[model samples]
Target: MSAAASSPASPAALTSSSRLAWLDALRGIGALAVVAEHMLPWFVPSLRPYWFSLGVYGIFVFFLVSGYIIPASLERHGDVRAFWISRFFRLYPLYLAIIVLVLALAWWVPVREAVVRDGSAVAAHATMLLDVVGIGGVADTMWTLSYEMVFYLVVTALFLTRGHERSGTWAIVFAVAAVLVGLVASGAVFGGGWPAYVSCAVFVLGLTGVVLGRLRTVSACLLGVMAVACLLLSSRVPWLGAAVLAVMFAGTAIYRWERGTGPLWPVAVTAALVVVAPVWAIESGWWWVRADVWLTTIALAAATFAGGMALRGRRLPRVLVWFGLISYSLYLVHHPLLKYFVQVSGDLRQAALPYQLLMTAVALAVIIGASALTYRFVEKPMQDLGRRVSRRCRGGLQGGGEARVPGEDAGDDRVLGHQERQVPHGVGDHVGQGDTVG
Candidate 1:
């Protein structure tokens, strides 16, 4: 498709009820891959080697989807303040609930001391920049959030500058940078020192920039610089981190191409870079790790994403769609539940394979059930509240006036049901929205 064909002039130009069922299915599949990646080693030992680190593959797919959708959301709103508000409500409520629940459980369950430490945990929660600030994630999956935050900052910057269409260019730049960094700074980048403090400072500044981005250009530029700096200097795995962002932007570029916002050239270039950067980084920076395994996983992730795009016009299975709806909760809740399960089960490796498999099935059931409740009670309600508040806030700003963006209206209650309709200000959207941090 031509770039102009995909690029709508304004947010109002797109249909609010235009749901991407295939994207949801991809999310459903990705969520299951993540869950299996974490759970299978404990229950199905024989299958461990064959799993090929589905966690990484799943997250890569999630990031690509985030790249594709988040930019559209920002453009759809055209108001950074509203975008940020939507994002805050979408992600934090569930996140806070998970943190509180985990911490409470930790009191009795013997959680990791490093995760619960006063300085690290407090800093992590306060900023949600735990991994960037050199504090380990309180939850193992949270490291991805820091990267997601950085992506948001960059997107916001690009949005404010009206440079959002340059996603392909940015993707290529970052990918090449990753390759260069891998070659030159492979070993030196691993140790954390002053960079952590620098990251903390950048995050604070970036937050301020986003808040002021709509009001001033300089703030937006500052946010952009901070995001780049964090990715380059502060990321725990700087080369791979850069490559990951490149992959995400490549997804964004593809979205722009699909939407007719930009030319196909950048998308084509970005697609090539995305495939090559990870393989090159693995070869250069992570020589000790199995290159074939990592390469195969990346290939699968790319293929899965391509398949979803190809089938975007078709209907997907309801069960998979339902899984996508609750994906964020599942991603957040499952790991900790697995940890608790291991604690309660007490060295299940000694158990017979059949018994272990049965226990795994039960654990999956419990996790899914918990995720369902959390989605209904926590995720859904909070998201609804966010929309109401954001609408009101936008209305108040516009002096109690409601201007309908393209396809939004009183009869369009189904609008927000599509994850992409909601701009994932920082993380992506919920479920198919960018909450796939695991």
Candidate 2:
């Protein structure tokens, strides 16, 4: 979920924009990896490889990006109410659009059987906590949003309490929890759909109070508790849920380390624990979960992120940055669009290898083209609207000083990890005195 607002106004803001592009680029790369993981097995089976799961690798990169970026966002803004409002607009417009689209397309492209088609599903989607609430997403790719939402809630709470700087500590805690939980809990520990309903209620009420500025502190604390509990009790794979949070905070930990405010050792420890997390779990049956391959995937994602960090000062490939620009749209629409093609074209795997390759290229091109359109018409407009609202709110709160943040003037955001599109800010900006930065 990242986008640049417009061009920067000053030399300082331009430097901020340039450094942040690598993050958006990572998001783009991650989204395409996810698209390939979903696309290849269906239409180009022979080309699909299982050694390193493209989907998981992509998701990890996103998790890290969001972890690194979100703290800066909330911290710099320093207003929970405005932060949540912006997040809502950034994430929901396209998200709800896709949800409805998937549901409407169900007749032609039947909804995945995993979807529960009930009140629970409704509750889960509303909170964007589908996976943690033990509910299937209407859009198959939406599960990751659950973790992103949880991170937001938890980070907000930390910011409210001024404990936001302990990211490295949280990373290790979650990583250790991942291994511990994996041994004993493979599936949801919460028994049924009731957790979804209950948590949904909590989410709605908590947000309502926070937004309304009534018992705001209490509401945020409760929201954080509810989010963490949901993660621990109801995630489809308990350990993976824990591990995902760890990955996110690990991103933050890395950012802190880069800023010279935190230690790098915890990040290393967190990585080691997460890499070995699946090795002994009862639920570790997926081929990609194999110790060696999982380690490779985890290492590769880190390396990719690290590479971006290393090359932050230098100008990157225009194509990579362009990928970042349309990343959110690409992430959300590609899968369902692929399914629509599968419906029309049938399995191209049965055709000649060249035809399969050609059709795959065609499908990819169409997806990219479609994504570009949605980015223009849907995502960018909503992001701009969200920022305008944020500006008004901020002005009202601050009594008229410039409360602008990086990527605010230029459009950019959370990768969707959909952390949503149009980043509020990215890593490497000078620490401005503001809200607990993303």
Candidate 3:
């Protein structure tokens, strides 16, 4: 399909309902940033400032986007079962394939051990419990997945209790409130260890923005400012709360006063953050910029939000859209692919830069190819099967006059459910397919 053709189905088609292009673009950018972060060692001896900024900031954008998109989709469908079904069908097949590939590569690669840590990271990653215990996956990057799952569970529980609208609202309220309370409770000033809470809150924040996005220009900006403010307060900022308030206040001013909303402002702001984050981090001299580093990530998250705002309802090229689609697969497997490639390429004593760059490019190309293959032959087929099974199971439930049990209808479709929409290829009632950066 042409790039334009691949832009998600238009919002006009859905009438008042619109597709969020910013989120898709942000997702694409986030995934690409992650891949690029992995590839950074090859190009620069000391990591570039921009690369560092993108690395930390990129994940926040992923979290924010995920917060907005997943619940929004669930609300769109309204059927809890269908929502879960869609999520699973979309994420699992490709995830499973990656897990298998990672396992296979374990025997041949040494760096893979560093990424996975041991068989446990793989096991933890496989279970999607990486964040709960904080061990993460072999990929190291999959830590976000753990944070994401906790939010999903929160959403799922709420959905089960109340329908999407009420539950989503409550989820947001509770999440925001919980974040505020957690900040107070932590007594760390900037809310230490609140990434877990921020994970859930940001998703709520994105959801809140989605709920209020189209109401009016003011409302959109207000909500966006609120989200940014919450994030600022949640992290370890240099000036702490004051800086957060200043940025949000300034952002609000832009929204209120700035006329002529073209893509440039957002693009500029986003680009600025993208460039500045790494430089600032290097300057600060923080080693890894742990959970305390959320201050740094805010700009990328905001840039993504701005990008999402700009792209709303407009289509980009199809190929870019597909990249967004298979991003999860690409993300899950990119670590292993790069690790193996780097290890093998180490033997080439030629100019390390050219050799590494060439290999990185080749690895990325292979990842894309593998992702496409997985999407076509694995994800799509399983998703189809899942939908069919869900329909059949739903029909059976209605016919038999009984409620459905979680795994009662277990089938290939379990891998493709709507709520199963994001990446955990393993362990969940249902998983979502879209957000893969974690």
Candidate 4:
């Protein structure tokens, strides 16, 4: 027998998987796009029409990446407790800190007088459950987190039921059905705030397809084309935004195909074209010039795919990596922080361009500083704590499985062994069971 057959995986195997530098780089770039999208007015008047529109695409990219990576990680550990703990530690601490900081700023800072006067908004933001209330303008950006939280709960439920033959498939189908039903029920594709949740489900299914190795090259390419067309249509008919929404998942499929061929240069060129296509269409007065909005959408999808491919195996500088790591916090805090500063600084939006730039810069500085500190103290610690707690809980479940029931005798060993072997895969390593068999 080969030596490899003699050695079983030990616990150290947990951290053995090589880090994918490309994902990190993709994240870093995504974070920057988000920052630029939020801070667009500081640079150019021409961007005003496109800034928020393009900025949203950046957030979508972040979600797509999450769907891809989070499932992949869960597949590896095969321990639900460890997975939940890790997620908690990674998210809650920084999240809580941001909430507290926002509250303090609203209450104590003279600049936040207007915000404090209407403190109900601050209460909603602090709970991290604002999305359910349909209350906007507080932590307005935490809207995405609502989707993220839902996804997490769904994934956890799936993990618990991993042994079920058709759970994964049903989940994906149900999610897609939800989006369609939502679209139809809302009487608009993307307008009604509730319809956006469909995107979250679509994203989950798309990534689920990738993890399960069920995605087809032809279908992915076709989906890509459809998505591109939908993006163009979205500008005119917003409800069809679901089409544009499909691009992220379609891009994930394409990224897998590109990885197989190693011809990233061609992919990069194609991505650039995808980005510039809408812009050109708009400039040429193609009767669909308004569709230039899709340029940013398609470009970002392609860039994320290409950048993800390029970032493979390479460690980016710490600064870029740091941005990627704290991107969520940045996204959450930047807007509120900016609004507060603008209000305090007095008529920031009304100010001259230079003054606008200065105010924006100062706000960004505060955001960065606060985010960094939050990441260190809150996000990191909470993530660690969550992981530890999850592991302990999962370990107890595992122990019960293996610890022989008193006086049960060793004859029941086969059942215990089967249970041990059948645990859900880790968050990182498990091949997504096709949605059909989760």
Top TM-score prediction, candidate number = 2
Worst 10 residues of 3 by lDDT: 424-433
Model 2 quality (TM-score): 0.88
Candidate 1 Cα misplacement greater than 4 A, ranges: 1-18, 49-51, 113-120, 187-209, 212-215, 275-289, 395-438
User: For model 1, how does the per-residue alpha-carbon lDDT over 234-259 read when each residue is reduced to its tens digit?
Assistant: 66566667877887888888776665
- Candidate 3 per-residue lDDT over residues 62-126, each given as its tens digit: 65556545554444444445544555566556666766766676667533332434454444444
Tens-digit lDDT track of model 2 for 1-438: 111222122223346656667787787788778887776766667777666778788888888888888887775665677778789888898889998898897787778877887898888888988888888887667887888899999988787777788999999999999998878777787857898899999999998887777777788889999999999998887788889899999998886766556677789999999987874452545677877768888999899999888777678888888777788788888878887887778766567888888888999999999999988898888877887786567543321121334434322333222343322111111222331111
Give lDDT per model, in order: 0.66, 0.76, 0.45, 0.42
Best by lDDT: 2
The positional error of residue 292 in candidate 4, measured at the CA in angstroms, is 3.9
Q: Is candidate 2 or candidate 4 better by TM-score?
A: 2
TM-score of each: 0.83, 0.88, 0.58, 0.58
Instruction: Pick out the ten consecutive residues of candidate 4 with the lowest summed lDDT.
Output: 418-427
How many clashes (backbone atoms < 3 Å, residues ≥3 apart in a chain or on different chains) does model 1 have?
Answer: 13
For each of the candidates, the C-alpha root-mean-square deviation to the true structure, in angstroms, is 6.2, 9.1, 12.8, 14.3
By TM-score rank, best first, the candidates go: 2, 1, 3, 4
Residue 274 error, candidate 2, Å: 0.5
Candidate 2: worst-modelled 10 consecutive residues by lDDT? 423-432
